[model samples]
Structure formats: C-alpha cells, structure tokens
Target: MRLLHLSDIHGRVDLERILRAFNELKADIIVISGDSESSSLLRDLAGRTRVFYVSGNMDSISVVETARELGMLLDGEVLDVEGILLAGIGRREEHDLNRIRKEVKGDWILVSHYPPLDTKADIASSGRHVGSRIIRNAINELKPKACLCGHIHESPAIFRLNDTVVVNPGPAFMGRAAIIDTENWEADFTRI
Candidate 1:
C-alpha cells in the first residue's frame, strides 16, 4: 500500500499544494503526525481521503477535540488498514512509551510527534540528540516496521533500528513530506 506521511502542519502549510501532491501521488492513505492548528482543514481532508492523525505538543486542545469529533484521532488507538496494524501515540511521556510497546503487534506502523533519541532523524542543528529516550526504548522493544514522527524541525531524515525504519518527514508546514511504499518497504522523502 502507498502511504503519504506528513507532520508539523502548524497552520503554515499550503493546503492546496498538499492536495495537489496527494492527487498526483495516488496515495491510499494520508498520515499526519501532529502540531497543526487547523482542525477544520484536517477534518475536510479526512472527508476526502483516509487520514489518521495524532495531536502534537504544540497542538491546542481544540484541535484534538475537533479531531476526536471527526473520529480521526489515532492517539492510543490501533487501526487495521489493509492487513497492516497501525498504532499512534500523541503525548510525549514515559507512560506512553510503555503503552506503545504494548500496543504494537505484528509488522505495525507507529506514528508519534517525537522522534526516537540518538537516531539520525532526531539530531538537532546544535548536533545534539533532541528526541525522546522513552520513544527510542519503546522502538527497540517493539521493533515495528516503521515509525513516522516529527518534532525537531531541523532534523528531517530516516534511520533504521534493527528491523524498523524510522522517519521524520521534516515539517510539512515547510513543504516537506514522504511517500512510503509499504509493500516494498521503501520511502521517498521529498519537498515541494
């Protein structure tokens, strides 16, 4: 299955361009990690395409409420799409780390707002690992097929931890995204 991954919308992204890319990419589903302020836009997008999302640290409570109203919030939930188990966690806490490890099953895809610590995807401009150690530990324990996240704006890259492929598609508000062909387990990171 082809999945379009995005994160850090934060009200600055051009929704029109994102729609154009969605159409051109012919994606089966659109996954947004978080940090968006516009829940109306997210709800509208979900009406048009299959969208799964989580609230970020920067997201307001209203945004989460709107997503919950639309039944699009994936936080602490597991969704089955085309035989793939997809799980997501929004809050950045150690408790969530334990929950995520227990939530994952089989070859699943994990979505989070924080990148795992010490990975290439979490390096900051200051050359520090500014990611979640809890997330990293959970990843090491769960070993999901892929982990999609974005929190540190400057750190946008892919990393591998054993059998898992971790990716931060940069900040979508900056016109960056990723296309993942899950069947072949390949990801193409791009900027528009």
Candidate 2:
C-alpha cells in the first residue's frame, strides 16, 4: 500500500493544490496529524481519500465529532490496513502514551502530533534538542515499525530507534509531506 502523510495545516484552505499532487501520486491512505481549523476540510479530504486524523491542540470537539461521523478514526484507535496496523494517539503526549501502553498489540504504525524530545533527531531552532520523555519511553517499550508525527513546525527529522523509523512530516501548510510505500516499507518526503 502507498500512503501520504501530512500535518499542521492550521486552517489553510488552499489544500486543493496539495491534494492534487497527492492524488497524482496514487496513495492508498492519507494521514493528517493535526491543527486543522476547519472540519469541512476534513470532509473534503475524506471525499478524495481514506483519511486517518487526530485532534490537535487547536482542534475542537466538533471537529472530532465530524471526523467520527465521517467514519474517520480518532487518536488511540488502531486501523488494520492490508495487514499493517495503523494506530493513532491524538494530543497530550502523556495521556496518549498511557493509553497505547495498555491497548497496543503487535508491530504497528504509530501517529502523533508532537515529536518526542529525547531522540537524537529532535533538534530545536537554536540547535539544542528536546523531545517528549513519554514518547521516547513508549517507543522503547512498544517498538512499533514506524512512528509519524508533527507539532514542532521547524523540526522535521527521520530517526531510527532500534527497529522503528520515526518521522516528522513537519508543517503541511509549509509544504511538507511524505509518501510511504507499505509494500516495501519505504518513505520519501515531498515539498510542494
């Protein structure tokens, strides 16, 4: 399966160009991390692709409900896509970790809004590094095949943590995204 990953739209409605590019790529799944201002955009997106979304800090309960109504899975839910287990953890890193610790099973694909701080991949604008301790702990324990995240708009990195590949797609509104081929388990970033 081929999947498109994007994050941090932040209410920008000019997604048509980006969506067109994604469509041309023929991706089977599309994942958006968070901070979308309009739930209508989600509905528009759902019309074009199978989307898995998580509510970011800026997302309202209404957006979550809209996603639910459209059959979109929220954070902390696992979706089986062609034998690959795609799981999402919404916001609040600590709470997400705790929930996943108890419920997650087998090798899976994980998604989140904030990139963990402790990983060598986590770098700040000042060149200092910071990440989520809870996220790092969960990665160390659960050992999923890969993890995709956003939040820190300036810090986008792909890191190998033991057997897993951790990727931050950065800000989609800033023209950052990734395409993952599940059949080969390969990922590539694209900026439009």
Candidate 3:
C-alpha cells in the first residue's frame, strides 16, 4: 500500500494545500504523527481518505476526542489495515514500554509522535538526543518493519535499526512529508 506520513502541523489551516498534496501524492493512507490543531479539518479529510493519527504533546483532549469519533485516533492501540499490523503510540509525558511491546506483532508498523532515541531522527537543535528511550528499547525488543515518527523538526531522516526502518517526516507546516511504499518498505521524504 502507498502511505503518506505527515507530522507537526501545529495549527496551520490550509486545507486546499493539504488536499492538493494528498491528491498529488496518490496515497491510499495518510498517517499523521502529531501537533495538529486541525482536528475538524482532519475529520473532514477522513471522509475522503484513510487517516490514522496519534496526538502530540501540544494536542488537547478535545482533539483526541474528535479524532476518536472520526475513527482516526490511533493512540495506544494496534490496528490492522489490509493485513498490516500498526502499533500506535502517541506522545505522552511518560511512555509505557511494556504496553508497546505487547502491541507489537511480527513485522508490525509503529506510528509515534516521538522519535526513538539514538537514531538519526532523534537529534535536537542543541545536538542532544531528546527522543524516547522507551521507544528505542521497544524497537530493539519488538523489531517492527518500520517506525514512522516526527516532532524533531530539525531531524528529518530515514534510517535503519537492524531490519526495521525509522522515518521522521519533519514538520508538515514546513512542507515536509514522506511517502512509504509498503511493498518494498521504501520511504521517500520530500518537500510537498
């Protein structure tokens, strides 16, 4: 399946631009990783395309509720889409490694708002690794097929941990996004 991965919208409201990108990319699924203030807009987009999302630190409970009602909230759960198992873990003050490990089945996909620690995608502007250690540990333990994440806007990259590919699409408000072809596990991050 073709998937569009986006993150860190941060209250930007350009539905026409977003939809144009969506249509131009020809994606079957849109996976957002967080920091969006456009829950209502996302709810509308969910009617047009498959949208699965996890809330970021900046997201409020109301946004979470709206996404849940739209069937697009993917926090702390496992969703099966066309035979692919996706484990969703939204941004939280504290992460639960045990819970994440439990949700990971063979070759699963991980959708998170925080990038795993120590990867290229986890570097901060201060050069410190401020990502989630729990996520890194879970990845080592579970060995998922790919982990799609964001939040570290400066670190937009695609890297590998053993067989697992890690991707951060950067901040979507900055016009960064990624397209993942699940058939070959290839992720191409671009300026959209």
Q: Write the per-residue lDDT of candidate 3 for residues 1-192, one digit (tens) a residue.
A: 888898998877466677777788888888888888777778777878888998888898888889989988878778889888877788652443445666668657888899999889999999999898877877787888999999999999998878888999899999999999889998998666
Query: What is the TM-score (0 to 1) of candidate 2?
Result: 0.89
lDDT of 1 by residue, 96-147 (tens): 5556666568878988888998888888999999888877877887788998
Candidate 2: segments with Cα more than 4 A from true spot: none
Question: What would the TM-scores of all predictions be?
Answer: 0.94, 0.89, 0.93
Candidate 1 residue pairs that clash: none
Error of 2 at 18 (Å): 3.3
lDDT of each: 0.83, 0.76, 0.84
What is the model-wide C-alpha lDDT for candidate 3? 0.84
State in Å the error of residue 138, model 1.
1.2
- lDDT per residue, candidate 2, 116-154, as tens digits? 666644677777666666667777788877888777777
Give candidate 1's whole-model lDDT.
0.83
